[model samples]
Structures are given as structure tokens and as C-alpha cells.
Target: MRAPLRSRPGPGAGHHQVLFFIAECVPFAIALVVLTIELTPAHVVYTGPLLVATPALAAVTMGPKGTLAALGVAVVVSVITATHNDAWGGQQVYTNLVALFLVGAASVVTSRAVQTRRESELNQVRRIAAAAQEVLLRPVPARLGPVRAASMYLAAETGAQIGGDLYDAVQTRYGVRMIVGDVRGKGLPAVRAAAVVLGAFREAVHYEDDLVEVISHCGEALRRDAALAGAGAAGDDAFREAFVTAVVAQIQEDATVELINRGHPPPLVIGEGSARCLTPAVPLPPLGLEEFIGGPPGRLESYPFAPGDRLLLHTDGVIEARDGDNTFFDLARAMEAMRGRTRQAFLEDLRDALLEHTKGSLADDVALIVVDRVDRSDPVRGR
Candidate 1:
């Protein structure tokens, strides 16, 4: 598993803060040097620009009041220096003071304008990101037939709420079908692949009766999208090694679930105060790489999904998340501890555990879906 990208807080702010602190000291030091050592106007003429620059720099890290304070000090110092040089009434003082005031005011205005534009751009980006996330990972219905479901996606990239990992669940004439998959890489390429698979699955779930056919539909969709990107934005090299590891599931009204694993992590079956693995008996190749298979792929694995049972399908991010000591997260241990948790609580706690193990950041994109077989007579759920 690839290690996820770790995020840092306020990187740009920290850098600016350091520069601002240093800038603050340099201007004051230069002014003190002029006030003590230099008496002639020619020797101190260089200090005018430095004094004006201080307020401009302050404008970036400080508000209007703070910037105004800096400007006041700079103007006062300029006047005092002019008086000491016996040039207070000359055109030199007027020219120097006017330049200082104009430049300082311009800096304040420029900083505020730049800051406002930056904030607007950030807001627009966030809005676009949220819309893309919704379209990519459509919200799962809380109830699908007799099942209770909840899903979560943890994106490894900084400020990215969605990534190559994708999950979707929908009710069909045949049954309730769901797919959880991960693209081979990260960034836009991976995201494009994920979008292809999701679009295929969402459409194929309605038309295809067999889960195997649905898997093929998703694979063909990936191949077509890859072909379109041929020698373009995404090259053959990316498509060559790029394949999606996926698991497609069909939950029958009879509480039986059929799983088709394609090089993805196995789902967990939690019920009766115990949790167990529901991995396919036969190994399967990942989607879009079945041509590499010499023979047949893995057979469909079925297991009884009784009332009150919960199914957890996840991407590699959760299992591969590492701690400070490089220890991998233990999913089985977490499931064992949360065997009887409600579907919603299980997903919430599971994410918390993954974050705790990884020190609040994951090494890769993660998508998790929890499916609960509803028990109409259950005491807690009945209320």
C-alpha cells in the first residue's frame, strides 16, 4: 500500500509570520542606527524607503488598525529626521514625506485587495470541491429496503474531501447492489478512473442482472475512458499499470449477500457479538487487468446475511494506515471491539480509530460502507 500524503496546518502563514517578525525588527533597527549615528540627510536618506516598507509589510500580517499604526510611526519618524537635518521646511522633506505617505497607503490598499480576492477564490474552490464530491460519491440512503446503511470517505490529499476511492449503493429490481473500489494511483488520473468505475456501476446496476456482468460493464467503461485519454492528458503508461481493485456485492431480500472480489480487501461480517471475514475462497484479479489472467477469475462467494448482521466493505487505506512506529492498523481487532455497534456508530468509531492510529492523517484514499440487515423486532431499532 502506498503511504498517504500527510497534511500540515498554516504552512504559508508560518512562513509569513517569520518574515513579518524579522521585517519588524530590521526597520526599527535601521531607524535607531540613523537616529544615533547619522545626522546628515544624505547619510539617512536611505531610511525613508525602509520606514515606508515596514508598514506595507505589516499590512499583510496585520489589520487596517495595525497597518495604520505602522504608518503613523513611519510618518512621525520621517518628520523627526527631517527636523533634525534642518531640512523640515525644504522641498526635500515635502517630497520625502509625501512619497512615504503615498507608498504606505498604497501598500495597505493593495494588501486588503489581495486578501479579499484570495478569500473569494478559496470560497469558490471549496464550493466546486463540494459539488464534485457529491457527484462522485453520491450519498447513500439511510435505508435501502430492509437494510440500514452508512458510508464514509477519507481523502489523503490536503484539503481534498474526495479522492480515487469511491463507494455507491442503490436498490434495483434484482436486489440492493453496492461497489467499493480504489484506483491504482492518486490525483486527477486516479480520480478520472474512479469516476469511470462509479458511473459504470451506477448505470449497470439497473440493467445487469448478474454481478459478474456488472463488473464487466465497469471494466469496459474504464477501458473506453482510458482509450479516449490515449496519448492525451493521461498516457498509455498510466493506463498500462492503472487498474481498479474492487468488490461488488448483491444483497438479496432473503438476507444473503453475494460478493465478487477483484483484488480488493475482503469484507467483514459482524453478527451475534462476533465478527468474521467474508473473503472469496478464490483469488481474483483486479478490474481492467483481467486480460492478464491466464484462466478464469474468482468465483462468486455467498454468505448468509441474517437480521442484525452488519457488513463492512472498505478500501486499502484503512488497513494500510500506519502509525508513528510504522505499524499497520489492525482492522480485525477494531471489528472485534465494535462487533455490536450500530451501523452509523461503527463507521464513526472506525474512522476515529483509523485517524488515531495514523495520527490524524491517512497514507492513502479510504472509502468505507456499512450495511446493516434490519431486524424489525429488535428492541433498540424498534423505538
Candidate 2:
């Protein structure tokens, strides 16, 4: 039996909140300690430096507002301590007060400037990521020939919208052809490879009648890209060892699905009340490593895909996610639980379940495409 997904807060949420509170309170806490020492008979020589540093410390955690508040507290403490020590009218006391004001104002301005620059940089990054997503992972249509399809992608790294994972669906002259794949590495290199494969796939699907030929075109494209990248970055071994695990599926008008999985997780098929994996008949090495296979690329394996059946194609990230106890996520069980949901809802809830299981921490990028075979005559369409 699979464990139910717990819709609780992220595991690190409370811990991060506690640490943030402590960091925010440190400046005020230091001021209180300094005041207590000044009031005592310890005769602390020079607390001016410590007092001057409080606003800067506050600026780091609380921005300009907290810096101003800390400046106020430091000013009040400095006055009270000076008066208590009977050093009120001395040049040293006046100099310390002036220094405090200067430091506080500087801290406030610097903090505000830094915050604005950071926000601007963040917005710029968002715009670039949005554009990259649009170009790299073109949206799968809601209706592709005889099947209704939806896709979702989640990048593993923070502030990233796309990564090594890739998927695309196209309605070609033959049928509705789709591909879901993952580059062997990550970051910009992986993205470049993914772009190459998708570009080849999109172009080849239109001309290549056979699914095998489409995959071959992607492999050729990846090899060419790797060779080009290797030439520019001399002695780089990433391109030499680069490979992509992929699966290409074609759904014809007769409701038959053909798949050529190359070292990737099998696609799942869900019927009215049953679901099963469409494992490849002869497993082949990933793209860019065809030399190791010793023969032609694997042939397309066909399976029954009746009307109203749902097909799930995904990268390994879906199953490789682990919980606090180090248990792997059960993809088939999750699909079973979310059986009756509408197309979009099913994908959304599936993502939520994955997040819940992993406590919002995934180790790798995830890309999934769920497709439903629908009759042309059916009045209802995918939403």
C-alpha cells in the first residue's frame, strides 16, 4: 500500500522562520546588552563602535525600516548611557552621536539602493526565463488530433523555469507525435542539448514518416551539437559523455500507440479502471551513445490505446523523488488515486501530490505529459 500524500507545510518552513526571527532580533538584542553593561559599574571604555554597527546589522535582515528603528534605539541608548556616566557634554560623546547618525543614514541609503538593484535584477531574470520557456518548451495543445494533451514542467533549481527535462507534442502528417526526454547533465549545457533535440524533433516529425527516423534525427542533432560545443570549449568532457534518455510516442487515428523508449521510464496507460506500463521490448542506449548498442535503434512497440484512455509520459524525476524517510514516490499509485479527475486538474493535483511527498524539495527537474484519447465525434473536448 502506498502512503497518502500529506498536504502539510514544507519541512524547512518553520526552521527557516525561526532563524529569520532570530536574525531580525540580533541588532536590538545587542543594543540591550550594551545598555545593560553601560548602566553597570564595569566602566566599559568605548561602546561607540558597537552602537554604530547596529543599524548596519539591522539593514541586512530588516532592510531600511528596521535600520532606522535600530538607529533610533542606538541613539536613545547612547544618550542614556552618556548621561548616566556623566560624560554628557564631552567631545567624545558628541563625536559618537554624530558618527551614529552618519552610519545610520548611510546604512539606510545603501540598503534601499541594494534592494532596488536586486529587485530589478530579479525582474530581468523572470523576463528572460519566461522567454526561454516559451521558446524551449512549446506548449502542448489541448487537442492534438485524436488525443487531448497537457504538459507540466518543474525545474529542479531555484529561479529556473526549464532545465534538462524536455517534452513536446506535434500533429504531423502521420499522426500525433510526442517526445519526452532528459539530458544527461544540467544547467546551460543541458538546455542547449534539449533545444537541439526539440528543434530536430519538430522539424523531423513533419517529414519523417517513421517514428524511428524522427528519433534518429534527434540523435544526429545532439551529436552535431555536442561536437560543436566540444570544439569551442576545449578539453570539456561533458559533451563527449553527453547522452539523453528519451521516449517518442505516436498516436494514430486507429487509437493505436507506438513507443520507442531509449533508457527512460516506461510510459503508463490508464484505462477505465486499470493501468499498466508500456515497457520497451528491446531497451536501447540513450541518444549520443548509439555506438554502444551494436545494432540498429530499437523498433517501435505498439499498444492498444482505446478512446477515453489516458497516457502518461514523464522523466525519471517523477519516480526518483524521496520523502523524509527516504522512500521513493509511487507514480503508478498516484495516477491510480487521481484517476477520475479532469485532464488539467489531474495534472495539477499530481504536481501537488509530488510536492507534498517530497516536502517541496525535488532533486531533479520533472517533465510530464498526460494525453487522453478522445473520439472525434465526442461533443465534449479537453478543457
For lDDT, the strongest prediction is: 2
1-383, model 1: which lDDT tens digit per residue?
A: 11233543322656876877886565456556655543654564455566667677667666566667777777777777777777666776687678778877887787678778888999999899788888988768887776778888777767776778989999999889999999998767788889999999999999888888898889889888777777465355575457999999998878689999989999988877667888778887888887876765555778989987888999998899899999999998898898777766777788888888988866787888888898655434521
lDDT (C-alpha) at residue 375 in model 1: 65
Worst 10-residue stretch by lDDT in candidate 2? 1-10
Runs in model 1 deviating more than 4 A are 1-47, 50-94, 234-241, 375-383
TM-score, prediction 1: 0.80
Clashing pairs in 2: none
Q: Least accurate stretch of 10 residues (summed lDDT) in model 1?
A: 1-10
Task: Give me the runs in candidate 2 sitting further than 4 Å from their true place.
Answer: 1-45, 53-62, 234-240
